[model samples]
Target: MSRHALGPEIHAQGTRFHVHSPDADRLWLCLFDAEDRETRLPMARDGKHAWSLDVPGAGEGTRYGIRVDGAYDPGAGLWFDPDKLLLDPYAAAIDRAFVYDPALAAPRGEGADTAPLMPKGVVTAPLPPVAAAPPLFRPGGLIYEVQVRGFTMLHPDIPETQRGTIAALGHPAVIDHLRRLHVSAVELMPVNAWIDERHLGPLGLRNAWGYNPVGWFALDPRLAPGGMAELRGAVAALHEAGIGVILDMVYNHDGESDAWGPTLSLRGLDARSYFRHEPDGRLINDMGTGNSIDCNHPLTQRLILDSLRHFVSAAGVDGFRFDLAPALGRLPTGFDPEAPLLQAMRADPLLSDRILIAEPWDIGPGGYQLGRFDEGWLEWNDRYRDDLRRFWRGDRCTLGSLATRLAGSSDIFGEGSRTRTVNFLAAHDGFTLADVTAYAHRHNEANGEQNRDGHGENFSWNNGVEGASANPAIQAARRRDIKALLGTLFCSRGTIMLTAGDEFGRSQQGNNNAYAQDNAIGWVDWTGRDREMEAYAFALAALRASQPDLQDVGWLTPGDVEWLDEQGQPLTVAQWEDPDRRCLAMRFRRSGLAIFVNGDDRPRSFGGVSVPARTVLPIPADQATA
Candidate 1:
């Protein structure tokens, strides 16, 4: 019952494609030449819902699409309206914008109206035509997490049309800012194709963060002006600026979502095999999104591996930050350190050399596997975030905790090397450095989830004021605390990640979980520049750049780093255990570079310690000794 018959002769070779509708009665392969005219080539249907059309000149710079015919069942997850054009999951470059139309989601039932919820089909541009080879800068990389749209949309200098697109990120003004900031890597939030949650769309909100992924190989047309071409151009621009690009990828689950979710791309193609299901054919909800991908399965693994290969080989991405990485390693029983996906990535020639960052936790049982990752992987140091927050917030019993975290959390990561940890005080998901010292609790009513969306245990102190205030004294205290946190993050022995707008004191107006608030709340406010915040950020970056000890690869031990009391002498057991004695000093040297950290809130005037005669301490302008 296939629509197109196999041609008498196989004239073309080395041309291939895929079709998702296995049960379809018919399928057709349509191609357009460089002039945008249809060639209407015939296709041979394979047994497994796949189709092939071989045309010698159709190899590259050719535009293609698939057409299918079948029953359109909305509730049962089968939306096979052949009348509607579909995009190929493996498309190297997308060409057009997704025009918003409700007819695309029209229900098949008689008299049923479906004009409001339909998403438009995006066209893919040919590869190599949209390809660019961007150079990589891996070693000594400083990652700055940012959102493409949010980063430039409000910037006054960016052109009106260029704002909120990948092209905007490459603007000379933007590039100059990044160069001045001294960040070597820009870890962009998820740019993979995604669907706005139905609830959000109905409520006049959008999935601003792009965490809900639908197509791994495709770039979200929403973030690009000329589709994937703009993305490639942006990467090339960043490379010209001497900055590497790291994408935040979500492979644990798809945007098709749980049972109630729509049949957009992968789910409609192969539900049972692609997704982890229950014994009764129900969806597995390990990701808290109604379905978890069966990464253990070969086909599913190939999907993920192919997606990664496409990014590196086709899109020119330098690295990836796996979101909810623990779920990818989960087996039927529990989490496996040597999961096939992990092993494959570690062994893959293309991926091994690039940076691999793991979020390291999910919502599943026994999900928190902090330090269990392999030697080559870098994990987000959640414990460091917690311990630093506690220490600066003046929580009781935090002095002991601070020491362990400052030494790279040997308790969590073991006492081998500190490079495995990615020390950070704040990231995209939670409070900014400014908000951490200004808000006591999350005010997430703006998220429309009844203030129950974000984390409850923030371990944050507002320094006596819940939110922003005009009081000079309170503002000064908050500014000092912000500097202290930045100092701790950069001074710690591990890879450091600074939130994008935190350098200039960006806040979400107390909305810790601003995933859905894509407006000014999420955008980087370039207009509002705080002199204190800028000075602190620049000072920390300069300090880290100047000191080799802060970025050391070796681990600290009792024999190397000695903790001293305020009196310039080593601490005793009783003094070390005392809760009220908040003041402590640490001295350590790495690669012949030495450093000392004073943890007390008050200044500790200790006598000069012995050091090489030529050694000098690099202090900030305000703190320099005459």
Candidate 2:
């Protein structure tokens, strides 16, 4: 049995509340009535640094919070104020919306009572029956990374009331798109209860991406008005359609920002125990999100593990893509693959067989831990993403690098067990596929950061023009590059992830970091979508599914795959390093693929050569031919 089943547990008689606060001298359970009046009950401390209380009338749907009384010193990392109501760390449902107010964080002892404005944790009943489905996504499966809110925000098929909600993902039109693309998993972005960043509120913006998580167990009411049942139904629908759901999780950090940030949840309950801090009490900002969670702490580890179990057992999610996962494996000594949390997850019964992926790096020391996780864990291969982009952009000495990535990136993931690379060209973090070919530079002025928010160098080529161009020649060239990039991605060994709108040539106008722009800039415009480009994507998916070599789950043995130059001969070291070579061919079993990228402004071609029957389609082939 898990040690930390801390939350509001309902029974036939009443409900019992369990909370962890080792540093608190006294704890009180605050219950809110329908008219907003508060009733306080003293809680008893248990032997294992926990507080417990039982109320006879408190059953399901009771709104409550906790207030711990202890030292209110920030330098020593003891922040306990009874004035500011604290949310349960394991809250399954939040009754109201969370609005960031600076006054809620006023230096511990100086802040006014914030219970009137604070949201309370609701005692939720057990969720609906979670279908016992086997894991649908695997090592070589294709994952479609999408945001529940932004994915169908502007879709014409979704009803206005259901648009931008988790229920919208189950609409027939959305499922049809996934089926067409042969997507095995839908990696839904953060749906956890989160708050808009404090800075964003001042800047007249909001956190469009739910990376700033607040409550670990509850679903954001804004995204899931119907609560866990709504999300479970959506997951059931996707499961019925043979698609798995991989949630993008943010346990690395919380919505609580810096020392001056809001005292919403963890910071108010037990800041010293919940968050990592320096000796003098300053936060460890490894996540680049103001504060890094104390992932290695015993209590924190149990909280995270329990949350994983709750999602899998109650909501029926297939897997999780951990954002900033390096923080989870980091300890005071350094990053250890054998970290307790990592080892526990690997050994756990509920999570052992599920898909676990890592965006395997943070902004801390030794943070660039790409391919450093355990064998069972898959990592987002940024090396594969960058090298593929640079090769198609005609960068010098890229043929050898491209070949390495095409063959499951043995350089990064190592040899035999390296086939778990999550290969991708574009993700939610950077520019879209169409924007990569249409704009060479990032245009993020819309983010109110003076066009300085996103990555400086995109490894992109604009086909001679900087932005959108009217010339037919440039458009044709850009479209050809798009096809070439998609060809390499599908043909690569290992798992492949496609961003939501990239299949049909969606553009962000060059706003790579549209994490703040929730309006037209971030939403996927289904109206007037590029049907031709979409068809091409469908064809590539079909081809990948049909080809066994492309979906190979192990490192290719010596004779399994061969790389060739444009002349249909084995690639020489000299030719591989040649800057002038922009064309390469790959042969696997009976099927062969040839990619010709004209990154240069003028036309370029290679001598005609005959290949095997399972041949490469013409660049930008007709949908019928495809």
Candidate 3:
């Protein structure tokens, strides 16, 4: 069962406000004026789980927050405190971004009124919904993962003022770059309003990624100075350029972190229903983010569904990439692909045909569900990422693993008629492609964690020297490896991802987990980018875009394709199991298109074609034999 619509509603005479707080005894509508004067109005209980009020004069641009008073037992998970002014979860816009303050997390009755410290939601008059259209993104196309501020912060062409904002992506330079890469969509990482984690402030660092979101619908004012308008305009521009926009959504958890974390939005209103809890009454941290949203709950499900629809109908975003997606499917027993919320998204009229991608893992038990999602959802295949890296790094027995990945990991997704894998060499969370070949380990000491943060086993290696090397020979070798990685990715059989600056040889020095270094280390250095690497990436994308065989989206069998050795002869069972095998040629029997890979230390010859060391070469002709 659904409750009445939440959030503020603007009418000709006045604005009506509604909220869902089934456990709250009373709720106050806290309205703030231009001079920051506060006015509180009591809301009447409408039905089972709603509290609403109508103000005759309160209309557009009215800044408001919710204050709920109820049981204050933290152990029981009821965190209602009237002093904690909360933003409406459905707040489509906010006056400013949230800043982390210790007072916001002070337990009930300990801290002074937090109204002054928190940002107030700005009431917005809904714009005409963006005209409905099908998503521009499709399977087997490039999904360029992007961090809005970091991606364009250092671009010389963008104006100084708009350099780090979302609107900068709409500029001609950005679109031209996307067009060159043949990007199907740009996945904007967490653009919603977020607060710096409490620990980051003391370290003189902040959350560079907006993963710690507070409100679901409101855009972070830092990324979008003009609020929803900024996002809407950018989406329109990208759509005009034949590119899609996919927002990286975080519904698994809210920024209102742990038991000691802030009482921002969901916590103060209805923590019991919004967040999952154990029998002893502790917050469940399946997402490893302190608190997990109880996505199975009807109220929580409704809130998430409304937010997804809001982005689609109001802002015209093409799709979403769910973060820590296992949390979205977890039931009381375990994660289920057919969980109610997951099914609801596919069945919902507004989202049925939308592009849905899942990160497919978390920190909880049974969280590593690689190919478990239903047929409609494409999953980020870490197997492909790791296998390809191992093969290129000269790991033994990786040739067969590389072949399995190139053929769309049928062993993983054999049940489906087509593969639902999103293959990639590197992503935003790890080392960039350039760093993958140049740094053997993570140097995230700049993150203020004493190099203690980030993954230890990266499966990365230095070509000859670690970090930045002045040796031209070392630099040239790294470039060759990067191009080889790009070639393998583009020639693979499923949809692929290229972290925004990865194609152009962006290096974080050696920082893999750069979620805090918002300075030069995190920003893409456009001026220093390798033009040759950029050209190679563009050419590979063009090839993938032009060829139908690479985009077949089906599982390749022996009849459909053949694997050959360096001499271009069919591989024997013994050769297939050889640990030192370094060359592979996969030819589509129907299209007669072959991709020759040379992972060895020296050049390898395939028929008349000579493939350089650490490279992948494509022969488009029907001459299948050497």
Candidate 4:
């Protein structure tokens, strides 16, 4: 038996499986039947660092784990405790969570005193039958980014056990809200199996956002209380509600982290081969983490492709958004558009119709390849976020930039389908919509990294007061600004992604970077809703759903949109270039819907200067047309 024959492969029946631990003096394959009875099977030593075992009638659904013999050196990144059974990296499903055990920190077979503190990996039953594929959604799809845990964790209407699990997202209450929101896709934060940072673990904090990925092929046991069955059910429910699920995947680095990080999985198996190491054998730190994965390697590429295929064929996932996507495209001469991974994805039969999105940047050299991706892919538009923030905050000389962004950032994305731009104002990484207007600076003392962790160039305003205040004028101004931002987001000619809880004015108490705060500081406080915010959120949702022109998937011609000045006349050179001139307008007609946006802070009105006189004005979906 070898590592290749352990899991469910196309030719899994009657296959022998084995694992090789070259550094270990001894190793044993622990196999279990469907009844959870374990048997210690001896492994035969094959030449050149290989071990093998044959298990008859041990196909899919048979649970298995391994025990490796080695020293427990914390400084050298070897944490091998035979007593603490380790999981197979290729396990189809994990049945239980890892409990904190201090004994796991000690060397194995030394003393009984260190036995009780070690965490043990529990074997899971075979995976359930693959679910049927959901109805296919097209590109130019509107995605609402959300956290599976936070969406239902505090919802008063959801059941207790179902709360914060994948099954809960499919509840009628949740689906109804999504239908009302009218987004075609729900881009979930990283649900791939991940571990909280060791620093956060000691502080009793967790990585609530799930960006740190440990296993790309497995679902996080934390999010699937009922196991893979529950995840499948959630996906089915989303399909029933006409919404698709897009997973945010991390491929730039593994959870093994830096030189001093844990080696529970891949790095321990093949350190020199799995990760990119420097000339002196030091791990490459391109991801700002301890180690960057060697995506250029053929085996590594296969693993990624296998993981993606598993998610689509087994888990019923509809799409994927790659985190720090530039790392996936990095070759010898910077980011290569024809990287094997990207090309395989485009050519793969299973992934051809799926929605592909890229974060488009990393910490590596020559990383910001914004519009350099292929035509089939969409990119998270950071330019749209910055320019929109600047325009609304009254930044000088931003009118030109704002116009370019509002028209789909043609400067960055050249000539392509308008849907290539995934327009967003605030994402999970930075300030929430409320914080963008309510905090002038980041206050990340809650993250336990002092105030030095999050980004400093926020381009935010306090509306005359930082944080929260009871001042009526400031509060009113904040509400108006929020409405304007939402209006701009929905009116823009591209796919829109609204962060969850932003519609109700969710805030993190000025903690712009609360990545490690698993507590209420990062949870959505549904109790904080005000009448104005609630009404505006509903109105914005309704408007986005009702406007065909705003949601058009086609590209816009020069004559399709006309820029206007404050006095209803065409924009002049002085107005377009003036640093002080913040007022701007865009009028477009498509798919029987007309859209007009006034980006100025002050109130301005427009008349019938271009369109048909008897054309009907589009009303909100929940409102009646006059």
When sorted by lDDT, best at the front, the candidate numbers are 3, 2, 4, 1
TM-score of decoy 3: 0.98
Task: List runs of model 4 lying over 4 Å from the truth.
Answer: 1-27, 31-40, 44-52, 56-63, 68-85, 99-135, 416-419, 553-555, 591-596, 599-601, 608-626
Ranking by TM-score: 3, 2, 4, 1
TM-score of 4: 0.87
Candidate 3 lDDT over residue span 1-626, tens digit each: 33668999999988899898988999999999989999999999888888899999888999999999999999998998998999999888989889899999998889999999999998899878999899999887899999999988999999999988999999999999999999999999999999998999999999999999998989999999988888999999999999999999999999999999999999888888999999999999887779999999999999899999998988899899999999999998899999999999999999988899999999987898888998678889998898898888888864678889999889887775332889888988989889999999899988888998887877889987899999999989888889989999999987889998999899998999999989899999999988988998999898889877787667678988999986768998888888898888998888888899988899888877888898998777554454
Instruction: Single out the weakest 10-residue window by summed lDDT for candidate 2.
Output: 617-626
TM-scores of all predicted structures:
0.86, 0.94, 0.98, 0.87
Q: Candidate 2 regions off by >4 Å?
A: 1-4, 128-131, 416-419, 590-626
lDDT of 2 at 577: 82
| Candidate 4 worst ten-residue window by lDDT | 609-618
- Using TM-score as the yardstick, the better of models 1 and 4 is 4
Give the alpha-carbon lDDT of every model. Answer: 0.70, 0.83, 0.90, 0.71
- Candidate 1 C-alpha lDDT tens digits along 1-626: 23342211122453555554565566666565555554455556666655665556444445665555565554444556545444555664445433324344444432232212323233333445324443374434467898888989889999989998888888999888787777778888998777766568656677888888766777887786576667777888898788888889998888766766655556645565567877766788888876788889766776687778767765577889999998888888899878898888878866777788899999988889888877777789899898888777776664667777767677777755323778888898888888998999999887788999888988787878899899998887787777777767766765778988888788888888888998988888888868667876786677777665566544457865666665658878787777666656666633333344444555545445322211112343334333
Best by TM-score: 3
What 10-residue stretch in candidate 3 is worst by lDDT? 617-626
Task: Say which prediction, candidate 2 or candidate 4, comes out ahead on lDDT.
Answer: 2
